[model samples]
Target: MRSNAARNALSGCLGFALIVLAGFNAAPARAQDQLKVAIGQINNWENQAPTLGQDAGIFKRHNLVLENV
Candidate 1:
């Protein structure tokens, strides 16, 4: 009787895991929107941070895309 209970518990756990995995897999991929932004100054080194942020994925994390001129 105990073995039957254990088997049922295991099956239930597996079923729950499968459902969670399926939910994750069925979710749609989110496409990040690319932004076109203009910075007033390109001649100065102070403008480097925005360029670095975009290149290092920091801007994407904050949902920003910068275009400097």
Candidate 2:
């Protein structure tokens, strides 16, 4: 036979565990797909390099979208 205190403690722990499990199961799914890129420094000659490649359709040829930021 279990004591009343032990039974109450066990029930409290089980309820908390169930609440935690329910929270984990109820996570959001639909997240945005965005890439964060950064460029340190820019050179005058190389500044338009990406633009030249883009104008020449090199990015399209390689299946890439190079956004300058």
- In terms of TM-score, the best-performing candidate is 1
Estimate, for each residue in 1-69, the C-alpha lDDT of model 2 and write its tens digit: 999999999999999999999999996854433333344465566556776776898766655667667
- lDDT of candidate model 1 versus the reference: 0.79
Candidate 2 local accuracy as lDDT?
Answer: 0.72
For residue 65, what is the lDDT in candidate 2? 67
**What is residue 30's positional error in candidate 1, in angstroms?**
0.7
- Candidate 2: 10-residue stretch with minimal lDDT: 31-40
- Reference-based TM-score of each model: 0.50, 0.41
RMSD values, in order shown:
3.8, 10.4
What are the lDDT figures for the candidates, one per model?
0.79, 0.72
What lDDT does candidate 2 reach at residue 36? Answer: 31
